[model samples]
Target chain A: MRILGIDPGLTRCGVGVVDAEGRAVRLVAVDVLRSAADEPLEQRLHRIASGVEAAIVEHRPDAVALERVFAQHNVRSVMGVAQISGLVLRAAAANGIAVELHTPSEVKAAVTGYGQADKRQVGAMVQRILALESVPKPADAADALAIAICHAWSARSAAPTAALTPAQRAWQAAERASRR
Target chain B: MRILGIDPGLTRCGVGVVDAEGRAVRLVAVDVLRSAADEPLEQRLHRIASGVEAAIVEHRPDAVALERVFAQHNVRSVMGVAQISGLVLRAAAANGIAVELHTPSEVKAAVTGYGQADKRQVGAMVQRILALESVPKPADAADALAIAICHAWSARSAAPTAALTPAQRAWQAAERASRR
Candidate 1:
């Protein structure tokens, strides 16, 4: 399955694409879309929407994984998140693609095996799991990849090749070796 | 000047268009777009976006008046408002139309002369100002008109003909006559 994950925001939105089968995952693309805070709200939204739409058209992922927004301490940020999520959801729908929303905790748990994993932990695991040389920069970028991995794992949990593939085992061994 | 006002919501979105000069305001069209709550979020947003885009295309309004979202007691509702507002803003930007956001208090005060006025008072004032036989049904619809009227009055505040037009005076008299 090919999945595109989005960590939606007004100032900076992160998008990552991954191709996965069974217990194996491979990174396709990852980047952050940024908009200026001083710009008019409509213009900012338009820019973000254009970037997201372009990714969807170019990647043609089977599904979009978005972070589900919940109440947070910062009311303003919460509103921004919801707004961007809405734009992404609409863009995916326009392309006749399905969207799956995963909560922050769910993404963390899926990637790092801990619901309350800190940003660094999640970032490290994503780097190892995708076999990237280094963790994706800007927490938002790693978060997006985490979301995609979460969706991919859940979707393929019942596959016959449930055992860790050679690439997955290699990463797991590397993590263990690094710890020693 | 012509203005298209939107009262953004997920389930029921109110849209109203008006043409105004000086203190005289005339309703062009008013209606509420409804989407089933059971529908997927993406589908619901797409439906609302399409409706708002259609209104903009048909009316060719000079500007769009949108209700500015703020923190509300209901978190879910607040999120919904922001989501819908974002969608509407994007649609306006796509068509090169400008959008002006008014707070609920601003809309009420513009029509009723009191920021703290109740919904009924605002509705009554809107009906009188537009010379309508009765207030528009569903508070959302009336609220949409109120927002447009607010924008119109603010935009024309510096016009040389700021004095009440003949139509405005007639409506003022009707409001006074109805009171007696």
Candidate 2:
């Protein structure tokens, strides 16, 4: 299974793609989508939507793993992140890709075997797990790779989409059929 | 000028279109976009994006007046509002339509002449300004109309998207060029 992970942001979005076979996870691609800080919110969002769609089309990942935005101290920043996350999710849904969101703590726990793992530890763990010589940078890319790894590891325990949400279910069913 | 006002929400988004000539404001349309509460977050967002885009295409409003969600007491609900607002803002920007955000108090002050005016007062003022026999039902529709009215009244003083962000200015310039 291939997983596309996104660490959603307005100024800098981190995306990583990985291929997981059983317990072996291998990295495919990792990049950051950046928009100028001075750009209008709409243009930023538009760029993010396009960038994520392009990534999805190029990688053709069976599922997208996204970092869910929780309430941050900075409302403006969190709002931007949530907006980008929603936009990416919509793009994935439109393209018939299943999307699963993981929290920061969840990702850290899944990746580093500790819920409160710091950035460097998470980065080191990612590098070790993916067998990369160096961690993906600048931090956001590593986070995306960690998110992809988390989803690949935890896919069976996540809440699968129900009947009404056809796009996600379609991807899920297709994956199941391919497995069969 | 015709204004498309949106009260952003995942479950029930209220949309209003109004035509303004000087101080005279007339209601062009009002409706609510509702998504099932149980729908997946991605599908709900996608549906809202489609609904807002359809409204923009059909109404052809001169500008979109969206409510700026503040740090609400409820984080989850506010996050949803922010996400939907971002989605609609992107849609409007894609259509080369200008967007202006108004706070709840600002809308109340502009429409009802009282910043702290209650919902009933705002609804009454909307009916009075639009010459309608009764307030728009479901209250959210009235809130949306009030927002459109607010933008109609305050466009000259609001930020106006000039000197704010380059993308908006660029879109503005392109629009002027196309008109010429």
Candidate 3:
């Protein structure tokens, strides 16, 4: 299974792609799309939308996952984030890709086994999970990877993968039962 | 000058077009585009964007006017409104049309001479301003027209009209001095 994760933002949106083989997931690509604050709001949104569309086209993921927005402290930033998220959702829908949203806590729980994990913990866990030499920069990129991993693991832990060998499947079921 | 007014909403977006001849503004068209809440977010946004784009193409407006989102009590509604606003703004930019924002209070004041006017009063004023026999059904349509008139009046009342005839120009200058 292939997945694309988007950490939607106006100035710096993060996008990460991952491929999952049963319980194992590998990061395929990751990057941040930036728009200058000084740019016109419409143009900034357009650039973000274009960048996300391009990423989806290049990666051709089976599903696109994004961070679900909840109550926000900053009204201005929240508005921008929601707008970018809407654009990404629309782009994925246009391309006939299924879309999903996971909250920040959900991603943290999936990656670090702690819903209340801090930023550093999430970045560290993302690197460890992807087996990368260094943590992805700007926090946004790392968050994107975490989102991707969350989706990959969520699917693995939620269902029995036909792709997995019989031994691997039994082990996965046993692991799931043990966790429960 | 032709102006397109957008009352941004996720479920029901209102669009109104007007032609401005000096200080006189005439309504060209008005309609509401509806999207079901049960529908996917991307489809809702796409429907609104497509409706606005179709209006622009049919009317060939010189500028687009949208309601500026301010602090709102309902966070969910605000997010949807902001997302729709972003989509409309991007559509206008893509078509090379200038876009402007009018706050709710500004629109009400422009139409009804009261910043704190109620919806009924605003609706009545919109009908009177446009010389319509009846108020436009669905408050959204009336509000859309109000926004368009606000933009037209704001531009005319704030700036000198170089296109005005000599007499009209002199009258405008005298009016400005009187306000001062």
Candidate 4:
């Protein structure tokens, strides 16, 4: 099954996708959702949402994986991140894509066998696991890929009979209609 | 002097501009930057940047005001807000506009005479201050106008000299050349 992973941010979001069968997974695409510094937050979120939807449309992934927001020291900052995540989740939900959220530690542990791996270490682990020639540039991009990889592994081991919820199914139908 | 205020967010960003003369401020424009829920963040940021630049070009504001990001409880969320703020700052710096930042509490206090005013109260304050018949739609949009109003009150009172800083002078010359 194909899976899309996202690392959502206000200024830039990283997206990656892969297909998995058993222990094997193949990279499909990876990209960064970027926003201009001067634009309003709502505009930026919309841009991010659009980019993610376009990617989903292009890839037609079976599932979407996103990193969960963790507690931080700043309230305003957390609010913004939550907002970005909200948009990401909304986009996936609108498309009827099943979503799985992994904490940073879970993603790190899944991808690197450690929960607190530094960015560079994670990058190396991702490259090694994905069998890529070089590390993904812009750390966020690599993190996005890692998130995708984590999902692929988790889904492969999970039950397959679990189907999309009715609401999700309806959304998928609506999304399909819109695409047409 | 003209001051532009921006309330940045992921879904909808409100932008407002006003002319400041000592304590008096006159509204110039107030609008929202909107993006679809499915669009990517990068494309959205680009659009936002373009929109802000277009507004700046049209209004030729003397200064720009932005809301300072307050601490949030989520690390990822804070990062996203910071990213948005970074883009906003970058856009202002690129245009050689004098940039000022105000806290949410500060803006609220200036506009509503209370630091903890609710959205509706703030909207009412904006309408009253700007002599509008109705409240600004979309809370974010009204917040943006409030930010501008705050700048007009505080930043304008402690006015910077008319002479441009060295960096601003260089940027202005470059901008002029580009225009020609």
Q: Write the residue-wise lDDT of candidate 3 on A52-170 in tens digits.
A: 89998898787789999764668778888888888887787777777888999999999999999998999999898889999999899999989988988785332446567889877
Give the higher-TM-score candidate: 1 or 4: 1
Whole-model lDDT values for every prediction: 0.87, 0.86, 0.84, 0.75
Stretches off by above 4 angstroms in model 3 are: A155-180, B156-180
Judge candidate 4 at residue A90 and give its lDDT: 54
The most accurate candidate by lDDT is: 1
List residue ranges in candidate 2 displaced over 4 A.
Answer: A155-180, B157-180
Residue A144 of model 3: what lDDT?
92
| TM-score versus the correct structure, for each prediction | 0.87, 0.87, 0.87, 0.52
lDDT of 1 at A9: 90
Q: Where is model 4 chain B poorest over a 10-residue stretch in terms of lDDT?
A: B155-164
Every candidate's DockQ is 0.57, 0.57, 0.45, 0.09
**What TM-score quantifies how close candidate 4 is to the native fold?**
0.52
Off by over 4 Å in 1: A155-180, B155-180
TM-score of 2: 0.87
lDDT of 4 by residue, B1-180 (tens): 677898875557789998765556778899888766587654455556567778888988777898887554345444445545655665566566677789999999999999999999999999988888899898888898899988878845324423467687567657745652
> What's the residue-level lDDT of B52 in candidate 2?
90
- Per residue, candidate 2 scores C-alpha lDDT tens digits across A97-165 of 789999999999999999999999999999999999998898899999999999988945233432226
Cα shift from native, residue B179, model 2 (Å) = 5.5
